[model samples]
Target: MSRTAAQFKLRMPAALRAQVEQAAKEARRSLNAEIVLRLEASFAQVKQEVSQ
Candidate 1:
């Protein structure tokens, strides 16, 4: 899939930030990449639900 590059700011609760940091470390991904992957997955799930 082709990806569109963009930049944005997000504010998250401290606890959530910690979780993302941990996951990013474990996955060997940058924090930004981890957050983007999560957002894309969430969007895909919502799309599937709406289609159903």
Candidate 2:
């Protein structure tokens, strides 16, 4: 990924944010990276589901 990336503003529940923060810490990745990883996986999963 490029250092120069588009910025997005997201609003989520505090509980969800906390959960993601915990996961990010455990995984040793930044919160943005964790969120991007998850979102990319979701798109791949949806594509697979649609093709099935």
Candidate 3:
């Protein structure tokens, strides 16, 4: 399925922002991509838990 991208501002703590930046660099993804990847992983974990 095709999806449209939406843009919004997210306010986060400086420490958390730094952590994400480091992880993004390590993962070789853009900051937005890193955030999306992490969110998808989190949702998958919840779905797996619910199914058990």
Candidate 4:
């Protein structure tokens, strides 16, 4: 299946932003990609909980 990507703005605390950026760099991924991956994982977890 093809997915349509949409741009959205997220506000993060400065400290949290720095942590996320550090993690992204360590993983060799762009910050945007890292955030998307994290969001997808969170959504999956929520869906699983809702289904149970």
Candidate 5:
């Protein structure tokens, strides 16, 4: 799907959280948007690799 909406709990190291938050701020995007964009890109990369 081109769009996604889901709610779930997530747990991660505090350091990782800080890194993501920092990147989000630098990109001028909300924390959630930054994470979603990255996750989508990661999946696309894996799919491409598998197809090759």
Candidate 6:
């Protein structure tokens, strides 16, 4: 298969979507970047918990 960044569709409540958009604007990141950053952080947190 050709190598490329994976793409997927997500559905969220309007309020949540607005919150993410505001955060992305403030952080100077695209909405996709914001979501990826959050996902990475969440996985790191889980790893830390398992290690403890």
The top-ranked prediction according to lDDT is 2
Candidate 6 residue-wise lDDT, 1-52, digit = tens = 2238888789999999999999999999989889889989999999999999
Q: Comparing 3 and 4 by TM-score, which wins?
A: 3
What is the Cα-based lDDT of residue 8 in candidate 1? 63
After superposition, which runs of candidate 2 have C-alpha atoms over 4 Å from their true positions? none
lDDT of candidate model 4 versus the reference: 0.88
- The residue-level lDDT of candidate 4 at 40 comes to 95
Q: Per-residue lDDT tens digits of candidate 4, residues 1-52?
A: 1147666688989999999999999999989888888989999999999999
Instruction: State each model's C-alpha RMSD to the native.
Output: 3.0, 1.0, 2.6, 3.2, 2.9, 3.2
The residue pairs in collision within model 6 are none
Q: What is the lDDT of residue 39 in candidate 6?
A: 86
Give the Cα lDDT of each candidate. 0.91, 0.96, 0.90, 0.88, 0.90, 0.90
Summarize candidate 3's per-residue lDDT along 1-52 as a digit string, tens digits: 1147777899999999999999999999988888999999999999999999
Over the stretch 1-52, how does candidate 5's per-residue lDDT look in tens digits?
Answer: 2346666788989999999999999999888888899999999999999999
Residue 5 in candidate 3 has what lDDT?
71
TM-score of each: 0.79, 0.89, 0.90, 0.77, 0.86, 0.89
What would the per-residue lDDT of candidate 1 be over residues 1-52, giving only the tens digit for each residue? 2257766688989999999999999999989889889999999999999999
State how far residue 17 of model 1 sits from its true place (Å): 0.4
Q: Which candidate achieves the best TM-score against the true structure? A: 3
For candidate 5, the 10 contiguous residues with the lowest summed lDDT are 1-10
- Deviating ranges (above 4 Å) for candidate 5: 1-4
